[model samples]
Target: MSVEGGAGEPLSDSQKREIAVWFLTNAPAGEIHYVAKDVRALLGDDAVYEAAAAEAFPEYNKAHLVSLELPDRSGDIIIATYGELDRNNYLDPRTAQVATVDHIKQTCTKLRPAADEELPSAYIEEFRSALDVELSKYVAEAYPKGVCAVYCTSGKDIEGPGADFGFAVVISAAKRSPQNFCNGSWRSIWTMDFNYELQFVDIKGKIQVDAHYFEEGNVQLDTNIDCKDSTIMQSPDDCAVSITNIIRHHESEYLSSLEESYLNLSDATFKDLRRKLPVTRTLFPWHNTLAFSLTRDLAKELALGK
Candidate 1:
């Protein structure tokens, strides 16, 4: 297909050749992303889809920016490292809003709140009966006021491996406050590649969350929290003590299994890629209410096959 030129001057043949070369040589595998903003502005979405199917650019999913047609493009085409769009000229919400709000609404309809959804009923009954007490005891001793309640929640793992086999327990705070006090969680998930995250969340602040995971056998420990909380503001240092408290409180078979999963991996290559690497990730916080509504939509868009 002879793709038409962009609204403004589309990337020239030389520019396209240079971008493709740069991507091959320098860009990490499968990191290149292309949006339809330029072609869509010039022609329309129909044309953009045609372009998306082209071999020159495979597709990236759920980028929030590249959901469907990028809202607008300052320049017709983009070719850069990961998150280049969100970097300079394209950072404005008006410029890079993900597929419309209606697009998200239509997709998330009839969807139970992610927070409300429980792991398949059988799992919830078992988890509550087995581990709730230990979790509550741990939380109570760890923080002032401790935990008021703990409940199970179900969600698919966004990365790592497949759908979770069980529910995650939400440790609710005894002294709840709108601004400061927030809940915490101990989530054990997976069938084959078992993984768990013990997280502290500030529901009052948008995207206020901190997570910790100790790879089995104390081989590794990863902290996955939004850096904006402490790293950016330079307030409290990374809360290693919180993680110590969470794990120190509960010593259970379930938590042990999660540790084993992380510990006993056969893939030397994958292990090399993961050895002792502290995983501090940026938070994609969308309140407990929004949960996975938009994520589900973007997964559908990219055909991520969940």
Candidate 2:
């Protein structure tokens, strides 16, 4: 089996054998195994100690750095012994940043109003701070596992007179491991973005929003919402909860329609993508071919007197 590792002293024959034995004893199924990452979770603390003692590669402590690959239908299982540190020195803790009121205010300061703009920066900053706090609270409580961003303004927009408060909330996070062609290793990734915006205008006020939801590449939705009401300025808490609910409702609708869309794609689009047989194609006799080969082998063995 082929063995690969990061830059360091090459693994000795004894070390390679130790890694292989560790895999055989722990990961019998030959699954994608991360020694440092999974041993504690799947096997226990003792397994972690055992793995550390066996492999003895202390340079990279993270589990993603060390892995063993065992694929089905294989002659010699490929034993990936160790991994390398990121050349770019990238690090990810996989935790969402909790946005505080001070954090939001700092973000607002940099968004200076344009020249000849009459919009009051202080008023907008105050409004954004209030809304940001409420929204941050809602996100922290409702989606503990999700990340949130409050969209603020410098108080100068074509929406006319009143300010606009918007935010983006992303939930149901997952890890992505895309193959890194340069090193032939997988890279971990996560991302956040807004897809579309909806705006509403009226005599009282206006609310503009951008919403998006993504899950397992099954469904994606983009929609606009133009809501006009004075409640946005009247009660920041209520507006924060209301906007969150609106986004949630749209996300629910998008997910609910996923099954129907998948079925339609399977029935129509999948058929067009599938390969079709030629009109003149016919089935061949597979039983005769196998029998003839077996008979020839048997005859040869008999002729050899074995």
Best candidate (score: TM-score): 2
lDDT of 1 by residue, 1-306 (tens): 134367866665544444443332322112232223343343433433343324233222221112222334221112212212322221112122222212211121111111212122443334333444454455445433322222223332232322332322333211212122221222221111112332232111011112222122112122222111111111112222332233332323223333344335444425455443435442223222111222222223223211
Q: For model 2, how does the per-residue alpha-carbon lDDT over 62-160 read when each residue is reduced to its tens digit?
A: 222222111221111111111111221111101111111111011111111123333224444344355446544543443322233333322324343
- In terms of lDDT, model 2 sits at 0.29
> In model 1, which range of ten residues has the least summed lDDT?
227-236
TM-score of each: 0.20, 0.30
As for candidate 2, its clashing pairs are 198-224, 198-225, 199-226, 200-226
Best by lDDT, which number?
2
Q: If candidate 1 were superposed on the true structure by all CA atoms, what would the RMSD be?
A: 20.4
